[model samples]
Target: MIQGDTYYFAVHLSKYYPFSKRVDRNYYKVEISNKSEPSYKFYTIKELSENNKYIEAVSIPPKKEGYFLEREEKHRNEY
Candidate 1:
C-alpha cells in the first residue's frame, strides 16, 4: 500500500450459491479518500472485464487441505 505503487489482488470464490450468483448487470465504483487529509474522491467505473486494461484474471489451482498447516507444523517440529 505504498504511495503511487501498483498492487494486484486476487479473489477466489467457491462453488456456492452466493459466490456463483449471476448478475444481469453489474455496476462498479471506486472511492479514494485520505483520512489524514480529510478529503474524498470517487469515480464510477465504466467497464470491468476479465483481461482488461485495468484488471486481468489468472487461473491458479486450488490449494489442497493442510497445505499451509503442514509447512507450519514442519517448522514447529524443528524448533
Candidate 2:
C-alpha cells in the first residue's frame, strides 16, 4: 500500500465565531496544496466551511491485499 503512506481525513463541526451569526452552515469542498518545492495536494471529500471547521489527517490500517485476489478468483468461476 505504497509503504502505508495513504492519507485519511477526519471532519468535525466548527465553533461559532463572534462576528458571524450561526444561522445556517454552508459547506464547500476545498482543494488544498503545499505550493512549494516537493509539493503535494489533496481535496476534501466532505464539504467544509471557510471559518467554521478544519481538516485533520488521520491514519487507518490497510486491509489485507490478498483478500482482493481471492475475491476476484471467486467471481471468475461464476461467469
Residue-level error in angstroms, candidate 2, position 64: 1.4
54: Cα error in model 1, Å: 24
Q: Residue by residue across 9-77, what tens digits does model 1's lDDT show?
A: 223333322212222334222332222221222212322222253342224443664886787887986
RMSD of 2: 13.9
lDDT of 2 by residue, 32-72 (tens): 22221112224333333232433221232326657867888
In candidate 2 the C-alpha lDDT for residue 54 amounts to 36
Provide the lowest-lDDT 10-residue window in model 1. Answer: 35-44
Per-residue lDDT, model 2, residue 50, is: 32
Candidate 2 lDDT for residue 72 = 86
Clashes of 1: 0
User: How much is 4 displaced in model 1, in angstroms?
Assistant: 5.9
After superposing candidate 2, which stretches have Cα over 4 Å from the reference? 1-62
Who wins the TM-score comparison? 2
